[model samples]
Target: MKVVCSYCHRLLRESPGEAVGVSHGMCPECDAYFAKLWGGLKLGEYLDLLPVPVMVVDGGGRVVAASERLADVLHRPRAELRGLRCGEAMACSRSRLPGGCGKAEHCRECTIRRTVDEVHETGRSVAGARAWVKTDAGRVPVTISARPAQGFVEVTLDEPEALAGALGGHAPPSRR
Candidate 1:
């Protein structure tokens, strides 16, 4: 098979094969070029372009990137939200406890943490998992969806009522 650069149409390599065919793939040059181009964009900046409230959580469940929509809902600056655990970012009451964030006992049963962890562990997506995040204001009901993206998980938050209505009045399944 002959491997050719999909972007520049440059011949990359040829391998022994019974079938004569061309495989389209990005060459090192094109890959580096695009990587450099995209590398110019900050994670938060790229995530802010998303329409919905979304956040990128690293393996440690830290908020590595957050969209402007999420920041607005959290009432915090996007830059400040970075490096915070999901619980802290969402203002979960347990996060304020002595151990803080994931260290608290309630962290084990936390839907948001569990959903994100499940997606990371199983490499499967969790959609519309209902969760009640206890904040300083009160217990706020929300629906969370998470998908593994590269080495990070992109978690989206939506209003429970809004998601329920979108799902034909049926609440999404709990992914405990």
Candidate 2:
């Protein structure tokens, strides 16, 4: 069989279809050279090093992928969050207002519901989105950053108070 030579840019013969090497003959020297030139040797290790919680969200803001850190925040196994609506998973259904009106009263009207829409509207990634997440305990403030990743969108959440301090702004004292 004939195979193209990587370095020579020409076709050469292979015995029973042995792949050819750089410009000359198939050899360990050429294979090593090519691998060294273009190969990701440590890609897996790099991904494992990320410390932040990473999440993949659909255009409708449903969680598609989430990291272990998110499990800690939501108090559930990471697998349990898959396919759940973002609003429902965040416990927004149960939040209460000063009048004791629950999330059933107005969660659909919350501003954070517009987050992904805003991203799509501006045609750009968003950073520093302050949103309310209702927990079993109560409503909580969170800061979000979002961008597209691997054909899907990604969002990350951080504590609003910590984010505010990092940005040199003060978090409003809790009213409760």
Candidate 3:
């Protein structure tokens, strides 16, 4: 049988007398790397270690945890972001409405909300979906990606040139 690293997809080995079929396993290098990076870390800590802006949201769309990068991108403290709805964390103008966040009528069409909901409901990932969010600073364009993780959904945001000015002329770190 053929064995490949599940994390990096690198070929490990092929048993001489076995049938030719791929089997997934972690390569030693990847195993050690992941162990060093995530061995004893909790979910929230792991999120912070990621380079890109990411947040983990519960089924109700409340942020359970967020990366420091996300807090930086939203110009809010990490402590303030937790337990708030996604729209509220992003400072969506409509999120401050009488009903708040997801309760606003305009929220029904929110791309980030819809992406998270779809991933949670279907256990599928949505990648690089373009969205325009109406924030206190006005509408900003962002690329959103979401994937179901355990019982929650992990959402990532990519703001291109739009946030450069807000970030003091430096572009947000690359997702890669």
Highest-scoring model, lDDT: 3
lDDT of 3 by residue, 74-165 (tens): 76778899999988887778999889987889989988888888999999999998987786567878888999999899998865456434
Instruction: Sort every candidate by TM-score, greatest first.
Output: 3, 1, 2
Runs off by more than 4 Å, candidate 2: 1-49, 94-108, 160-176
The estimated TM-scores of all candidates read 0.67, 0.53, 0.75
Give the number of colliding residue pairs in candidate 2. 1
Model 3, residue pairs in steric clash = none
Off by over 4 Å in 1: 1-40, 160-176
The stretch of ten residues in a row with the least summed lDDT in candidate 2 is: 41-50
Residue-by-residue lDDT tens digits, candidate 1, 1-176? 99899999999988885579988999898897678668797777677656667899997799988987777667678889999999888777789999898789988988998998899898899989998788766676888899999989999886544433332344333222
lDDT of 1 at 17: 56
TM-score result, candidate 3: 0.75
- Candidate 3 has its poorest 10 consecutive residues by lDDT at 160-169
Residue pairs in clash, model 2: 8-23
Model 3 residue 82 lDDT?
91
User: Please, what are the lDDT tens digits per residue for candidate 2 over residues 1-176?
Assistant: 45555574455655664654433454455667567546654422322233554466676667777765554455556778777656654555443443231235564565555666566455578888887765554566777777766555666665535433433344443322
Q: Cα lDDT of model 1 overall?
A: 0.80
